[model samples]
Target: KAVICETPLGCFGQTICYDLRFPHLYRKLSQAGAQILVVPAAFTKKTGEAHWHVLNRARAIENGAFVVAPCAVGKVEGGGESYGYSLIINPWGEILADAGSDSGLINANIDLEEVNSARMRIPSLRHDKSFQF
Candidate 1:
């Protein structure tokens, strides 16, 4: 399912941790005018250790949109653990800020112009063509 939110800045979409693995969902959101994507998750230590950062960065790079993923780092109530590494990735797949294992604040100067620049250079969104046999 897709849910697009309108903020004063622009339109944004949000997804859970598991949803980040699906590209089509993000594609649909971006297609529908989502300039930013939020992934708020309490990823398990097992999975979070392996794929958290890469997935977030990949999503930003592939969609040419900002990805703001905040992952819970500590262990949960049910004996589950969280891998803390909240990230703010830019449209160019650069990590603007990262919250490390400990509780800390991350700040970055985000310029929306960069989104336009990346999309202008590689307009993949406009070039997708679907075909089936």
Candidate 2:
């Protein structure tokens, strides 16, 4: 389903946390002309430590879209620590800035031009999707 909705800036498809596991969804969104994917997440300490950074970078690198994820930090009630590596990743799998285990705002200087260049150098997006099943 091709969907579009609104954000503070404009319209955005409101996909939840589980959707991050599906890279194809991101590809579809990017192919549909999305430049940025905003992921507002509150992942638990266990899962976020395991896959957060890699997945965030992978999706951006794959689709040439900037992935901006702001995550909740600190210990929650009932003795749980939220996984707090809030980050902004570029299309080159490079972390622009990351806030680790602290509650704060991270400002990054992002250039849209880098996305095209990173994609061109590797060209992985065009090479993905080959399947054996």
For each of the candidates, the C-alpha root-mean-square deviation to the true structure, in angstroms, is 1.3, 2.9
Off by over 4 Å in 2: 1-14, 126-132
Q: lDDT for model 1, on a 0 to 1 scale?
A: 0.86
Q: Rate the local accuracy (lDDT) of all candidates.
A: 0.86, 0.77
| Cα lDDT of model 2 by residue, 1-133, tens digit | 5455545543343455667898888877776666567777878889999988888898888887788888888798988888988889887778998999888989787776776687788776677666898
lDDT digits (tens) for residues 98-131 of candidate 1:
9988767777777777778888887988886788
